[model samples]
Target: GMADETILLADDDPMIVDPLALQLRREGFTVHIAVDGEDALAQARRVTPDVVLLDIMMPKKQGWEVCRELRAESDVPIIMLTARGEEMDRILGLELGADDYLTKPFSARELIARIRAVLRRVAMDSARQASPAAETASDDDVVQLGRVTVDRARYQVAVDGEPVHLSQREYSLLMALLDAQGAAVKRGDL
Candidate 1:
């Protein structure tokens, strides 16, 4: 639950940060604040936060730079926040490995929802990785969808018991979709 999660909020504006921090705290998250990009990186390394809410404009270092550095060091989920809603900025954030992005003037509820979604996605990914592909898998490893059966252990797939050819990328995409279990996977995530 949110009670156990720590959130690092990095933004220069107290007007945005103070109230937001209070709201998050009210929702039961342990909140950490950073006024600049450098401080953001510092707090992130120190606290090892469960998630990061990074604002795009800040002193010392920009959000994209911070996002790039953080992604290089850890798989911790990052949600980029910005007043700008340009498509290019959103694309750049995703390209830099941000887990999600939110434009400013957003409701606190939406922000919280995004945070939870990212957390859920990260947890699912971790669970998937915890089951090593190198280890032998029992019958439970097989996932069925419609006429397709995926043998995760064997890295093979069959349709109606007939082997189907799939590129590595295709197989990975298929696995990700199956992992969602009907959840809507955002395009940026894919």
Candidate 2:
């Protein structure tokens, strides 16, 4: 169903990369491999992939560096791959703007499920944005503050009829503040 999707798999191990590539291809995804984090960044810029499966420990540039750089330049979905015991690494990955995370030694089926779920969220958000009128609004869907308008259903914001680009966290924070409707939102409330 996702034949048009392209996934960038960045891992130093051929054993992991090769088998994962085959499985992903069989499931109708185009797979690209990067042996190092630096190569991963280069390939991501070149190919403009749909999603990235990044290994936390890689040569050249570490996955954290790659994820930070990618998040700065684009909002592409990133799923971090960490070793079994690296709970801190997984949390760090998310803080660095990863859309999801999967630990090492995971089954291909689980990985595929995560990818599909992420893609589906994106698709649904896109649909919501495209047809805002079709969805019911309970004052939380859209917010207007001065010239800026926030469309929470689609994760979009606009100012003076022009679209504005915001990262996921930025959008969430904006929505939260607007939800308060000019009331003081304590730091803990936010």
Best-fitting candidate, scored by lDDT: 1
Candidate 2 lDDT by residue in tens digits, 40-143? 99999999999999998999999999999999999899999987657788788899999999988899999999999999977776776685443333435666
Q: 136 in model 2: Cα distance from truth in Å?
A: 6.6
lDDT of 1 at 9: 98
State the displacement of the C-alpha of residue 14, model 2, in Å, after optimal TM-score superposition. 0.9
Tell me the TM-score of each prediction against the true structure.
0.71, 0.72
Q: Who wins the TM-score comparison?
A: 2
Worst 10 residues of 1 by lDDT: 131-140
lDDT of 1 at 185: 80
User: How would you encode candidate 1's per-residue C-alpha lDDT over 1-190 as one tens digit per residue?
Assistant: 6588999999999999999999999999999999999999999999999999999999999999999999999999999999999999999999999999999988889999999999998876667658654222323678766798889989999999999999999998887777765578877766
The C-alpha RMSD in Å for every predicted model, in order, reads 10.7, 9.9
Model 1: residue 71 alpha-carbon error in angstroms: 0.5
Candidate 1 — which residues are off by over 4 angstroms?
A: 133-190
User: Quick one: how many clashes does candidate 1 have?
Assistant: 0
